[model samples]
Target: MPHTPGSYTTSDLSRKSGDIIAEALRHPVTITQRNKPRLVLLNIEDYDRLMRQSDARSAMTLETMPDELFGEFETAVGAYADSDEAGR
Candidate 1:
């Protein structure tokens, strides 16, 4: 198999933990087991940033959504209701 940068096997993790962790502090690293990607190692800052980005994307209130998006959502709901009534 081709070697991948920032990827290490389980055995390499055991033997070179310090080096791997140092690299992870600079950028994310992938840990592999049986040649399959298993885990990611990253610095706390990167992890926190990723979590914040995920929360921002997933947790949105109608009050926070822009007017255009709210209008589109309203139209979609209205269409769904019309379809349901037609089916009934």
Candidate 2:
């Protein structure tokens, strides 16, 4: 299912909770309080998909990197550490 961002007030949500949740299955719904956005309603699948994407983006294994590239990385880290110490 495809979804677009939609905003709703708390009172509005309270009155139409079921419908709102149904809509959330298709897209994220922003809950507002005092006319300001506060919380989001979304399907569990959407939540899981987002978490998976985050994990994929953060997946890094230095051990899998080429030796030459990793060597340069080590050198860069050493340089950065030296610079940080100098700044202290």
- Candidate with top lDDT is 1
- Model 1 root mean square deviation, Cα atoms: 7.2
lDDT of 1 at 16: 89
| Alpha-carbon RMSD of each model | 7.2, 9.2
lDDT of 2 by residue, 1-88 (tens): 2223577888978898998998888899998888778899999998998988784434458978879978998999999999999999
lDDT measured at residue 83 in model 1 versus the true structure, 0 to 100 = 100
Which pairs clash in the backbone of model 2? none
What lDDT is obtained when candidate 1 is compared to the true structure? 0.93
lDDT of 1 by residue, 1-88 (tens): 4549999999999998999999999999999999999999999999999988784455679999989989999999999999999999
Model 2 worst lDDT window (10 residues): 1-10
Candidate 2 TM-score versus the reference: 0.56
Q: What residue runs in model 1 are displaced by over 4 Å at the alpha carbon?
A: 56-88
User: How many pairs collide in each candidate, listed in order?
Assistant: 0, 0
Top of the candidates by TM-score? 1
